[model samples]
Target: MRLSGRQIDCIRGGRGVFSGLDFEASSGEVLAVVGPNGSGKTSLLRLIAGLLVPAGGSVALEGGDAELTLPEQAHYLGHRDALKPALSVHENLSFWRDFLGGKTGDVGQCLAAVGLGHATHLPAAFLSAGQRRRLSIARLMVVRRPVWLLDEPTSALDTAGQALFVGVMRDHLAGGGIVIAATHAPLGIETRELRMGSAT
Candidate 1:
């Protein structure tokens, strides 16, 4: 599968963020969006995920499910963990699995993969930042989405958690998925860079 964005333009809060930007990623490819702050990295991802409508240009995915739109076939993991503080770890994942209808995996196994098996019953409010991030990773595993748009995916992750996430991403790519990540830190995996703005 191939995802492409052409001549994209973004305007936020009545100010232009970016314009005439283009990007493409295929199956098993990791595209890292990097640049200084306010360069529209997150805006680009949001556009591709269909969260924000582009002022100009278009985003498309080829060789994907014809019945679904690009956003429907993609997973957007933003800076926020998007967890329910009132729910347990497993409950949170279960909610996502049910809400996102697609190929599903075992929630327990996914939690174990992300090192959250021991905290399956723990409320999200009591988990640390790193743990919250791990739980989000587990959410990704439980739902099958071909396109992953990650914004600072490694944030709040410790050394080991970051390393573990690398493996998770690798597994996703090995399964022929595409990852588009906006990050300041290294993803700890080989990726093509899509630098934004004028920063060198």
Candidate 2:
């Protein structure tokens, strides 16, 4: 599948964030978005994920699942991990699995992949920064989505966790998935850069 955005524009609070942006990514490819703060990297991802509507232009997927909309086929991992603090790691993952209609994969295996196997029963509030990030990474595994939209995905990850997540991303690419990440850190994978704004 091919995902492309043409002449995209974004406005927030009646103020312009970005305009006339264009990008493309095919299956098995990674598009890394980079720029300084206020460059609209996150805004671009949000537009692609349909979390925010574009003021102008369009994002289209070519030869993808026709029955589902683009947002339905994507996994949006924003800056917030989106975990319920009161819930255990397993509960949080399970809830997302059911909610997202995840029909495959073992929750334990997913947690183990992120090095959080032992903390499955622990409340998310008790997890350390790196551990919380690992848990968030686990959510990506429990449910499968062709498109991954990440914002600062490596924020609190340690070196080992970064390496582990890189492997995970590689596996996803190998399986014909597409990843579009907004990050300041290196992704440790081959990718095409989509720099935005003058600050970049």
- Model 2, residue 179: C-alpha shift (Å): 0.4
Give one clash count per candidate, in the order shown: 0, 0
* TM-scores vs. true structure, each candidate: 0.98, 0.97
Pairs of residues at least 3 apart in sequence or in different chains that clash in candidate 1 = none
Which lDDT values do the candidates have, in the order given?
0.93, 0.90
Per-residue lDDT over 1-200 for candidate 2, one digit per residue giving the tens place of the 0 to 100 score: 99999998899888888888999999999999998899899989999999899999999988878988999888899888899999999999988888897345788999998999898999899999888888888888889988999999988899999999999999999999999999999889999999888522
Off by over 4 Å in 1: 198-200
Q: What lDDT tens digits, residue by residue, belong to model 1 across residues 1-200? A: 99999998898898889988999999999999999999999989999999999999999999999999999999999988889999998899999999997999999999999998899999999999999999999888999999999999999999999999999999999999999999999999999999898422
Please list the residue runs of candidate 2 whose C-alpha ends up more than 4 Å from where it truly belongs after superposition: none
Q: Please report how far candidate 1 places residue 125 from its true position, in Å.
A: 0.8
Question: Which residue window of length 10 is worst by lDDT in model 1?
Answer: 191-200
Model 2 — TM-score against the truth?
Answer: 0.97
Candidate 2 lDDT score relative to the true structure: 0.90
